[model samples]
Target: MSEGHENAGWRRLFGGDDLTFGTGFPLTGTRESRPDVDEEMRLAAHAEDLGFDALWARDVPLYWPRFGDAGQTFDPWTWLSHVAAHTDEVALGTASVVLPLRHPLHVAKSAASLDHLSGGRLVLGVATGDRDPEFDAFGLDHEARGARFREAVDCLRTVWSEEFPAASGEWGELDGDLDLVPKPTTETVPLLPTGRSRQSMEWLGDHGDGWLFYHLPDDTLDSYLDRWREAAGEKPYAMVVRTELADDPAADPEPRHQGYRAGSEWFVDYFRRLEEMGVDHVLVGADGDDPERGLTRLAETVVERV
Candidate 1:
């Protein structure tokens, strides 16, 4: 809950009470193929210009036909770094990086490097990963992901915050003989656990800097927020909603998978409700024929008005 860190990006996104908006990547309509790098970069810069608080990138190491979504179709570290260089001020976040799939040392190194490079704009959302096929492909035990997740988090915190030659249980042994260079601008990068990650609510509150969860109904969201407050005690809570904005300003809401298909008016009211319920940041996936137009419309109609 303390904002004494050097990362201005973290301060800008989570340091206030007003609801903030962020857009998911791929900033284009291409779902099955890779997005045009130039177009995505342009839209990313445009989003920053439009006053979006953050830009989210996903980690999808491999594509699965059943999963159906490629998720920005880029390596999250590289993509965030590229976006970091293109825009200034807006926070750059990973919608999530699958921690159990990769080594904690590598993740810590890369994340710290990015934090320094971007002047502390990185917010890392990590998960145990949901894809069964990915676990098989990686030659990892899907069932053990939860345990691995805990260990990886411990490793990250130790290496980022403690002095060189730190020793972590089971994660690895970092002898004082050598050190991980380029520590984060802050004492530690903000780590937000996506969903439960097979962890208890108390554990999340104690360990995570914040919580990143999926969309929920009004009643459910309220209950969850209440529990989170009891457990996490003012730690930030973020959610993602997949929206398809309508052209009509007065359009009502129609439910989608986890979000809604609605007009600007409904969105404005919905966001206000979320703010009232104490939700911190909302990362939006505004799906439409013209993704850029969808982003601009939300920025103008919903973000500005709210």
Candidate 2:
């Protein structure tokens, strides 16, 4: 249950490789909270049962002004912990926790607690937050969040590892005499970066265990993978895609956000392309349908087929 133990377990299970085939947080229907947490988690459990490797949650507190959709529509840590209680095998992750807005201790505590509760199944994706309004609300500097993020990462690791770890930074002071309690199951949880986050791709690849982002065209995907490979020295890559299922297997895909609106046939083929492109995982966002019916059909057609 300690952070070191969790890190060790993470290394033991994952072996520092990418895990493929996960379900992204659903965003179907209105955000007025009709779809309860249990309903959302049942969908995730189905994903796990169908051999999907992971489930992800998104972190967006108050629906930022410019950002159109409110992601996942829950408090992310609470959601993850709730989902963790329900599922057995699937890895639980945040697409990217907006680290700058939160105190690192809280983030570390919550993430480590989830890891312990889930038996070392937490993958902590972090980002230097981009929403200016959020930073303003937190009294944090968006311009300097990148530096703060790095410091937070370092701080989290230190607090997890050493008893009474010391850190000197503008963010705060952890005078070498205070260490975090109930450490993560692993010494270090899998720290993945979302997008560039103001750091160079090399910096990300060098420091992060993996990367998460929305889908891009093949050319862009390849370019980004190439950069990751070069900097990572064989680190893995990951991404999420939006998807909608149709009744027909051969239904042509219409353009959705970062992915296409496609049928099962196109869906399977998309995964193939992702695999060929060296993507380690694709967390499909099953938005806009009856959650059970939608996921069931996809499992039968796309997930089972391929």
Candidate 3:
């Protein structure tokens, strides 16, 4: 795998050149304003049973009507705790927790607890947060998010690795006074920065264990890989793809937002191309009407066959 990601859940999932697959939470359609917890849990367990490498949950602390997506309608930490109790092996990840929105100490403590509880299966994907209203609602200066993001990353790492009283700028200084309990099973939890997090590629490469980005076209993806390799040599790169599997196995590809609508045959070939391009892992979302059936078909055909 990569240099710094040796003991990470991400490395376990995307270690070699095999190009593994994972599925996003709320596998159901986006039109449903709220998610059914029971159904989601069943589907999550089923996805793991179907041989998916990871199960991702998003951190949407508040539902914004304008954003139009409720993001599984649960707290990521709480929900993942629930998932950890039920599943034995599937990796659990936060498709990204907004670091700038929450206090870094809380994030560090909660993340560490989850990592220990889940037997060291936490890969934290963090971001600067995109929703403008959320920043306003939190009474934070949205413009300063980039700076806060960097600080939070530093703070999280310090609290997780150092003894109490560690001095962290803006996150507050601990003078050997108190400690954050339940450190991650490993020395540090894997941190994958999503979409630059308002920082430069150099900064990301230096700090992030991996990169979690949205889907890109083939040519765009190749170019991205080139830049990422230059900035962070051999670090894993993961993307999310919205997939709608057609009934006919021979269907052609149709472009959707960041992904495609296609049949199993096309998907297998497409993923092969992704593997060839050095893409590490693909997070698949079943975008069809029946999420359960869609995920089952994807597993039986594209996921399993590929």
Best candidate (score: TM-score): 1
The lDDT for every candidate, in the order shown, is 0.88, 0.75, 0.85
Q: Total backbone clashes of model 1?
A: 2
Model 2, runs deviating above 4 Å: 1-19, 27-34
Candidate 1 vs candidate 3, TM-score winner: 1
After superposing candidate 1 on the true structure, give the runs of residues whose Cα lies further than 4 Å from its correct spot. 3-6
Residue 193 accuracy (lDDT) in model 3 = 96
Candidate 3 per-residue lDDT over residues 14-65, each given as its tens digit: 7666988998887665533677777888888888888888889999878888
Model 1 whole-model lDDT (C-alpha atoms): 0.88
TM-score of 2: 0.89
Model 3 misplacement above 4 A: 2-8, 30-32
Candidate no. 3 TM-score: 0.96
Note the residue pairs that clash in candidate 1.
Answer: 165-175, 165-176
User: On a 0 to 1 TM-score scale, where does candidate 1 land against the true structure?
Assistant: 0.97
Which number leads on lDDT?
A: 1
lDDT by residue (24-132, candidate 2, tens digit) is 6753444544356666777777777877777777788667646765677788888888888888867888878988778888888888888888888888889887667
